[model samples]
Target: MGPVLRTEHLVSADQQTGEIASKIDAALTQLARARQIQRQCLATRHGLSPLQLDILMTVAAGEPPEPSISLLARELGVSQPTVTAAVITLERKGLVRREPLPPRRTLVRLEPSGQPALADRPFVDAASRLDPALQEAMLEGALVMIAHLVDNGTLSVARTCLTCRFHRSDGGHYCVLLDLPLARSDLRVDCPEHQPAA
Candidate 1:
């Protein structure tokens, strides 16, 4: 049985609320499209394909599964051949190198020359100008959306507090690993300590 709500005022069938939700969805889509276009621009500027730029950025983020072709394929949601082909292009450009690891795995390593592609993130630059309060609120909401995507299997991975094993919502927001209560502003989107919840 579904739990009861304290009031029916916010139900989705309400015209105003439904319209607001639709607007929010459209805004999010535009935001994503804008970011993708910006990345494509940046890719062209640096003479790299968007896929190569993504591979470099993934390596720079340093969160694991450590950038093997198969790992990158899964991480970037592309096929192994596609990642291999892109990696070849990146390698020829001196942006990355292939290293042999044990158990017959090939590790893709970003080189110093690859740094330029990972630099100049337009969204990060723009978001940095937001006021602290707005930044925190945006981050909190983004984590919630990311968590929802992960739950829906739209995203294979997220290293955010919402998907972490240590997040406790039984009482107030808390981090068991940190042993601290979280204010909305204290919520983290990509914590180094993040461990996925089972």
Candidate 2:
């Protein structure tokens, strides 16, 4: 027969697992609530729907090699058509523009009209709702969770050096993938070069 587990030990293990699960659930719930509150405030301040505001924010964050509709859809966890529809609405409002590039790729960027929205107090106030240390902790937790989800196939996006095998934590952060050293603050939340750790 296999080794038998003591009843007391089993009960203790079960209780510990339950407590951890509850804490995770609470954290997720708090994040969801914060997002909802921020979305509501953004909608009220900008006279835009939450989805529109989300699209605008995503587009606003786009750097060179601007984000495509499909990429935005992937990041937002929505259908491309849904993102496209929102883009159309945003275009009508002069908040965003679609620039056609060669070879049939379209790039999305925030228009001048949308810049004012980014500077509004609602976004700042909502962001500051959480304490700075708490926000950093939450972001770190989120990055780790996202890395886990990506490894498990529950999520497909959010590639970061933290999840890459080449990431080294000795003394300071370093990435073998890029052959570059990274500072703690310089660590990217999303990196194109991220290769999942084996």
Candidate 3:
């Protein structure tokens, strides 16, 4: 028979879980601070605000049916006026263009002239010595965290499988749109093809 857990043992286990959770929270906080610093540095170096850089990065994808001001506001979790102000500045700098769409809506598109900085990814995919399995696990864990954030309204947008209409997972991951099987690594954090599950 298996050894029965006593009250003290259960309490000890609960404490351990809390302690581990605290440590993970602390580490995440450090990462957030580092990200803020990186964003500030990059934004200053390129003569743009952090919000402007983020907007540019989002639009740099150059997807069809270009993002409108309202969509950008919703995606970025910011007010419409804030996004509109940023878009105006970006347009003045020739980094983006405001195109009129039907029914009195304006869409945002990249200028296609300058913006060498914003077009490229800010964070380099640094070489890691971690094993492939460990790396994949890390990626899966991060996506799971992102999904949780989206659920709790900490994040406004996440074009990931968790909310994607095309994703299906009975026991395995698959994409209906592409009609393709998805390995854990095949999952995308920010997919251009993502459509809301609703």
lDDT of 2 by residue, 1-198 (tens): 999988766657778889997999897898789778977787778888888888887777664224788778878889989988988888899898998777876778888889877664454576579887776666666676787888888887666767878898786778876788985546777676666677
Which model is ahead, 2 or 3, in terms of TM-score?
A: 3
* Residue 9 lDDT in candidate 1: 55
lDDT of candidate 3 over 7-59, digit per residue (tens): 75565777888998899889889877977898888788879998998888777
Kindly give the stretch of ten consecutive residues in candidate 3 with the minimal lDDT sum.
Answer: 118-127
Model 1 residue 107 distance off true place after TM-score fit, in angstroms: 1.7
lDDT of 3 at 166: 97
Candidate 1 wrongly placed segments (more than 4 Å): 1-13, 170-172
- Computed on alpha carbons, the lDDT of every model, listed in order, comes to 0.87, 0.77, 0.80
How far does residue 58 in candidate 1 sit from its true spot (Å)?
0.8
Clashes of each: 0, 0, 0
Candidate 2 yields a Cα-based lDDT of 0.77
How close to the true structure is residue 156 of candidate 2, measured as C-alpha lDDT? 71
Question: Estimated TM-score per prediction?
Answer: 0.84, 0.74, 0.79
Give the alpha carbon lDDT tens digit for every residue of 19-100 in model 1: 9869878999999999899889999999988998899888878767677999889888899999999999999999899999
Better structure of 2 and 3 per lDDT:
3
Best of the two (1, 2) by TM-score? 1
Best by the lDDT measure = 1
Q: Please say which candidate is ahead in lDDT: 1 or 2.
A: 1
